[model samples]
Target: MSSVATASSGVSTPNDTRAGASTPWRRVIFGAGVGNALEWYDWSVYAVFAPFFAQQFFDATNAVSAMLSTLAVFAVGFVMRPLGGIFFGWFADRLGRQRAMVVSMAVTALGSLFIAVAPTYPSVGLVASALLLFARLAQGFGIGGEIGASYTYLAEAAPARRRGLWSSSMYVAVTIGVLLATVQAAALQGVLTDEQMTAWGWRIPFALGAVLGIYAFYLRRGLPETTAFSNARDTPEPEKQSMLRGIWENRIAVLRVVGLTVGGTVLFYTWAIGATNYAITVKGIDPDGALWAGVIANLVYIAALPVWGAVSDRWGRKTNLVIFSVGLGALSFPLNWLIQGSVWQLGLAMSVALVVHAAVASILPAMFAEMFPARVRASGMALPYSIAVAVAGGTAPYLRTYLAEAGMPSAFTWYTILLLAVGLVVIASMPETKGKKLE
Candidate 1:
């Protein structure tokens, strides 16, 4: 197996060369890392500031209502992701991945800037919330497209046998972004009173994200497109199918990707978002303590991602998915039951659970990309994944809160387990894509 790196001009296609000869693995990983870090930095800022933003932007008569409103707006962002994915994915396939990346990052930066400068409800009333909504939607659209383009570009540019190792950088960057958000939230909580947080401290992270977004844009400006896309474009253009038509044709693959995504995204929100709330509201831990727990657990998961990806490269993508599904399904309920006593204990349980999820997250890009040809791979992968994210991931935190309020906190655990079991069934039906060529 061989791979090549396409220069940014959209004209030069370099032949496959070793890490020492062409663009080094370090450079490839750095570019992918910076872009992914910025992407998740924007996302993590929203999750971290949800409670505070709720107070500032929505009617904050009750704690529950505020949190619920925040999550509702968060869900709205996921709804726009697929549209961004389709538009940018098609653009990437047509114009070039480098161009697609530049546009996505630029849009996300603008969105973050909008959120940073937006007024509070007291000043602008409904229009304040409206501006926040538009910003989130814009960020959602950019993120929806960014991941597919970055993943495909990195995976295709890597050494074939070690693609898993190289591609794992994406999740590592995501974990770092999550960690940054957690730490920033913790730091703000330490310095500011709750009143101050609700007043203005909450905007700091968004402001920081806008700065990071600018840095990411400059980094991405130098990134080359992937050779696979270049070669595909050099050949005669395939009949450009409508997004809906492509989804209809690839229904089975779409279902499989959705199934896989549901488990991964659910676990992500449960650990990253729901767990933080659980620590504060249920376990009586301080907000800073809860943020620290997430930071530690995510750091551990980030360290583990590449190892799992390499294991999948050797063992098979299906094997990794099966293990992830079964392990997470059996363990989620037990872990949730055990997370009440100590912050350390909660962090340990969350770390263990997320390791199972890392197995899936680490290799999903390659697996999804392999499921379809280049013609529709971006839309095919992005739409189903985003839809599942909106339905499952976007709802996990809110649903968990509702279940807790209904005096059935355990029900949330059962729900996640059931989703993992369903994902296992879906993985069973899909063929193993280990070592498959990206045809």
Candidate 2:
């Protein structure tokens, strides 16, 4: 655990000591990465399986309303994310990232268990819907805090020179989790009849999520607290200074986090969740085809993440942002049009867009961590990032669906382009933090 803060990057280095040489890179990555994967798996499964379970929790007569109810619950869960951030970010800052992450996973697992065993509308009426809402709220809260704690840990654990690459690992793990969920959906659809999937098969993923979450909790417990937090902990604090006060002191960095997150979160939800959901629900594409298409597209995204991470390290964080905003902005309309109820078109469009998306996705965690000193780093990033995601990202899928149902699908595409344009403006004002030292 012995370390020194290097002069150049202000990051702790082991100075070629035994600890440095023996740093368990694999365990560190797996502990952090796997937990992230589990978090997303739990989060994404709700949307992936919503089509099947929508009627189970709501009125069965109006199918569209039932689906909307399910998505609304999904959005409600997302809305709770900021509250998760406020509490968990403070917990991470005041206590430690490791503790916050472990506790959040427990809450998430409990939520999954609730959904796994929730009574259906036939038996319990609106009570079923209430249980679903309660479960989502819990999951949302856990996920909210999970992001700050995990991102902070990964950023601090990484060597300064390779921070960008390390940051990308979180999203790579995220894509894997999403891929696994899609795979599960495809598998269930392949094996079960529609009636059977709706009746029972949809519950399998939630039940498995609870079990996997427990295992992730076990793995995370073994991870060491990062040197940055340990060092920050020992330093004297101003008497009675609160986490919110510290975040306020770093207000500019907090604003930057919001701006950096806004467009990327929206872009991520659109391609990752909205597009597939759209193809199935609106375009009438086969569920298996849509989910399988997502699998291939996600794989392409995974491969692109590391390459973009390298580019960010060599060029700068701002370079990646520019590429993401402009490239995705220009291609947004055509990609939207490409999803015409076919598996190949859906696969091609998602693959191309996600490749462009990797630029920003690869470096966001590092950029946010680097923006503030360690004292308020977790909270500073957490609040604004969660707020942005809740406001824009959480609403993305619903908005896309609503627009398409209104026979104005092109409007949603325009909305995406506008956000990307705004993101470009934010990128222009952003400092290049490629090799910057974390405080």
lDDT of each: 0.77, 0.84
Candidate 2 minimal-lDDT segment of 10 residues: 1-10
Q: Which stretches of candidate 2 lie over 4 Å from their true place?
A: 1-23, 55-68, 121-127, 280-287, 337-342
Model 2 lDDT per residue over 233-271, tens place: 878755436887888888888887887788898889999
Tens-digit lDDT track for model 1 on 236-292? 547666656766798899888888888789888888557878778877877666767
Q: List the residue pairs that clash in candidate 1.
A: none
Error of 1 at 418 (Å): 2.0
The true-versus-predicted C-alpha distance at residue 202 of model 1, in Å, is: 2.8
Best lDDT among the predictions, by candidate number: 2
* TM-score of each model, in listed order: 0.89, 0.89
* Cα misplacement distance, residue 249 of candidate 2 (Å): 1.7
Clashing pairs in 2: none
